[model samples]
Target: MALTREPPAATVDPSNPNIVRWEDIGLTLIHNFITEEEEAAMIEAFHAQDPQKEGKRRISQHFGYHFDYTTFGASETHLTPVPSYITNFLPRLPIQTYLPDQFTVQYYPPGTGIPPHVDTHSMFDEALYSLSFGSAVPMQFRMSGPNDARKMRLPKRSVQRKSDENTEPASSPATAEQTQANAQAQDAEEQSACWEILLPPRSLLLMTGPSRYGYTHAIRPRKTDVIDGKTVPRQGRYSITMRTVRRGDEIGCNCAYPGVCDARIREEMAARRDGAI
Candidate 1:
C-alpha cells in the first residue's frame, strides 16, 4: 500500500488558474486570494486591535474563543465575535458549507518563526485555512517520525496485567524482526517527503485530510529564504489562521490518522485498561 494518498480531484477547480494543488499532501495554495488594498486594510485592522505599541518579535490575538497554549484546548465559551473586516472575505473562501468561527492573527518579524506543530485534532475540524499578508515566507511540512507511523498502523490490544501474573512475550522473534523492518522502511519514506512551500503576500493556503492530520508545519527562523537558487530577504509578516471549532458529545476524534489524534489515543488507552481516562 502507498504511504501517501492523493487528495480528491474536485478539491481544486480545473479552470481556476490561481489554484496550485499539492495533491499528495492535500494542500492547495490560492495565489492572490486577497487584493493588495484589502491586505493593507487587514493589517491596519490588526494594528488597531494590538495592545502593545512597542515592537515585538511575535504578537498574536485570538477571536471567537481564547486558545490555551499550555493545555492545547479552546475555551468552551465564545469570546468576542470575529471582526467584520475579517468576515468580509469569508464569501471568497473555498469552503462555503460553513464559515469559520475561530481565528488567530499573528505577527512575525524578520528572523522569527513558529515551531513545527500539528493542530490538536479534537479541538478543531479537518479543514484549516490561513491568509498571509505583509510578506512571503517558506513554510515547511514534514511527515511524522517512524515511531508515530508504526503506532498508527498497529492495533492497540494490550490490556492491563496484574503484577503477579506471568505472561509470555508480546511477539515472537520473527514478528519483532518484521516490525523493525517496517519501521526502517517508514523512516526512509518520510525522510524523502519533506516539502517547503512559499506562501506569498495576499495568498491563502488550505490544508485538509492528510496535510492537516498527518504532518507538522513550521517556518524556520531566518532572515532570508532561498528558492530556486535565488535568495529572498524576509520581511515582517502577518497571518490570519481560521478554523471551525468542533463541538458535540462525540467520544473522540475519529479521523483516519489515529496516532496523531489525542482524543483517539486517550480513548484507546482507556479501553485497554477497561476504565475511564
Candidate 2:
C-alpha cells in the first residue's frame, strides 16, 4: 500500500504542533503498516517462547521491562534484555526516538475483551504503541463523561496516534453539581466527538495526546463485531504492547493538559469550576 500521506497543510492544527486533526480529535491511522510475512514471522517467534498465563484470560510475556499487568506499573521491576526482533524493529518506526523500552505480548482467545480504561497516567510516557497479529479486531474508543458516551472503532492493519490536547485520562466520579451540569450540557457539542479506525492484522497503534488521556478504549466482550452492517466473528488475537516507563517517584507534573495535570489543579483550585473549558 502507498504511504498514508501527512494531512494537507490546510488540515494541520496550528495550536498543536504535533498533530494533524480531523474534526476536534488528533489521530492518524496508517493502513498496512506491516506485511503478512512479517506478521507471520512474529507469530512464529512468539510461539517459540514459553508465554506465561496472565490471570485466567490472557497469556503474555514481557521484555526489556517487566510490567505489573494488574497495576500497569514498571518502576520497580528489573530491566531485562528485549528480544532482537522487537529492538530491531523499534528503530524502523517513524517515531524512532519514542521507541519503546518495554513490550508485552498478550494472547486473547475468542470472546475475550479488554474493559474500557485509559493506560495509567504518570506511570508511562505519553506515547503508547501496540502491534497486532493473529487476528483482526475492532477496538472501540468511547469518551468518558456523565452524559451519553459516543463511540469509535479501530480497524485492523493500521497505526493510530493520540495527540496532545486529548491525552488526559477519563474523569473521575462526578459530584452532584457536576451531574446536574452534565445533564444540562447534553447538546450536540457536548456529545463527545468519537473516532473509529479499522486496524487490520499486522497493524500498529501509537496513542498519545488527548486520545491517549481523555478517552477510554476497550474491546467489547463478544464473539462478533458489527462493522459496516456486517458481523465479523472474533478469532484468537495477539497484541504486542510497547511502552516507555516513567522514572522516579510520583510528583506533580508540569504538562500543559489541565484535565490530567495535578500542578494545574493546585495552582488554580479556587478559580476552576465545572465545565470551565
Candidate 3:
C-alpha cells in the first residue's frame, strides 16, 4: 500500500516579533492599516471611474512611467501625475525609500478569482504593497522553484498558527535524492496542499525579499470562504496594488530574479560581467 502524507498547514512565523507570518516567507501584514474613511475614499475614487475604461478585472494607472497592458511592456506614454491623496499617504507609512510610480486596482465580485502569478520582476521594483478593502477574502500563494511547491492560504480576519507542540515544523534541508523524492511527492500532493492566512478588511500586506521572487499568489474562484468552520459569502472586494516601476539605465535593474527580467538586458549584463562581449 502507498503511504499517504498529510499536506502541511500554515504556521505563524515564530521568528517575527510583529504580526503573524507564513514560515520564512517575507510577508508582513498590518491590520487596520487604513481608517474606514480612507478605505471609503479610495473605493469611492474607484467607483467614480468608468469601469469599462480599463477593462473587466481592474483599472491601471501610471505615475512616473506607464505600462502597456497589451504588450506587457513599458510604454512611452505621458506620465500621469500622482494625486495629492497618494502623496499625502506616503509619509504615513514607515517605508522611508518606497515610492510607487505605478498602481493597479482590481475589483473582484462573487465567483471571481485570479490565477497564481508573481508580479513581473524586471517591470517593477523589489517591494510591492497591496491594500485590501471591502469584504474579506482568502489569497493563495505557492512557491514555484525547485518544484518544492508549498501551498498556502490567506483567510479573512485574524489567524495564527498553533504552538510548536501541536504543530509539525518545516523539514530540514534534504539531500539530492531525498529532495527529488520530496518534489515528486509534493507535486502529487499539491492539489490538496495549502496554508491558510487570515486577512482582515482594510489591512496592508507587504511582499518583499524571497516572498516577492520565490512565490506565486492567486485567489481561487469561489462564492464563499470557509474559516473556522464558518462560511463567509463573497462580497465586492477591492484590491489596490502599488508598485514602483523599474526604469531604464540607472532606474532599471540587474537583479537575481531573471525569470521576470528582460531577456535582452539580462543577456547583455551577463555578457558584460563575463567579458564575453
TM-score of each: 0.76, 0.65, 0.67
Q: List the residue pairs that clash in candidate 3.
A: 152-195, 153-195, 153-197, 154-197, 155-197, 155-199, 157-199
**Which of candidates 1 and 2 is the stronger one according to lDDT?**
1
What does the lDDT come to for candidate 3? 0.61
Candidate 3 lowest-lDDT run of ten: 150-159
Residue pair clashes in candidate 1: none
Q: How do the residues 1-277 of candidate 2 rate in per-residue lDDT, one tens digit apiece? A: 1112232222444664433334444444444567788777777787788554333366778887888654456746567688776776776565766677778888888878875566655667777887887888877665554332211111111112433221222444557676565455643323344334556687776677766666566676788876677999888888888887777664335553445333454445545554444
Q: What's the lDDT for all of these models?
A: 0.75, 0.61, 0.61
The number of the candidate with the highest lDDT is 1
Q: Which residue segments of model 2 deviate by more than 4 Å?
A: 1-24, 51-56, 146-195, 249-277
* Whole-structure CA lDDT of model 2: 0.61
Q: What is the C-alpha RMSD of each candidate to the true structure, in Å?
A: 8.8, 10.3, 11.8
Per residue, candidate 1 scores C-alpha lDDT tens digits across 1-277 of 1224322343456899789887877889999999998998988888888855347448888988876564465777747788887889999988776478888889998878865567778878778999999999988777766555444334433323322111123563336566577656655654565567789999999998889888877788888888677998888999998888777763257777776777877677778799654
RMSD of 2: 10.3
